[model samples]
Target: MTNFNGFQKLIAIANEYGIICYATPEECLVASLPGYDDFLLAFSWSGAFEGEPPEHELIAISIQDITKEVTVAAWQIPTYLFGNVLRQAQMLVTAHQDFVLRTNNP
Candidate 1:
């Protein structure tokens, strides 16, 4: 698969959990979800494919909470774990949203 196809596959996996990601001009995958938008979640992969990706290659998933001006989450894992990591990321974003909402309301 070409790099675009690889990114598209990743986008599809992220969409399964309602996270919308698109390729930026810089060739980075960025999330533009509601609660997760401010976090600027960006994914990076080097030579990852949908079928039998290189074991040595790692995908970096990171969330930088721009609202709080800090990075709240970051993870580097093999391509095979992409789906699992995306699920965890969705949970993390939900938790952060809840925390911010409560803090603001209280």
Candidate 2:
């Protein structure tokens, strides 16, 4: 995983690559729906598939300082590395959501 300096850098990368990180629970859940988008939600919705994934999208290292693993869209992760596609979907949702929060409120 890339040692990011901060969320701003991640946001920069996301913006440059057209990486549409879904930042909403509904978006996350919606992206995870297999038949809904043909499983495209497992990845970034905008099709920018290059670069080291933003930390929010990294399954190995999810949110820290939390008492328990947080659920993203449709699966549990941040504590285990074996989460499946569902977890990936949730991760995107969580990451994208976080991105929006940071960008909007920063």
Q: By TM-score, how accurate is candidate 1? A: 0.58
- Relative to the true structure, candidate 2 has a C-alpha RMSD (angstroms) of 14.9
Which residue pairs of candidate 2 clash? 23-96, 23-97, 73-90
- TM-score for candidate 2: 0.26
Model 1, residue 19: distance off in Å is 3.4
Name the lDDT value of residue 37 in candidate 1: 58
Candidate 2 Cα lDDT to native: 0.37
Q: Please give the CA lDDT of all the candidate structures.
A: 0.71, 0.37
lDDT of 1 by residue, 1-106 (tens): 2487666766776677566778777776788545455767787765545676465457778877877887667888876666576567668887877987999999
Say which candidate scores most in lDDT: 1
> Please, what are the lDDT tens digits per residue for candidate 2 over residues 1-106?
1233433443444445443444433222112233223223322122223574533343222222122334333333321232354445445755756775898999
Best by TM-score: 1
Q: After superposition, how far is residue 18 of candidate 2 from its true place, in Å?
A: 30
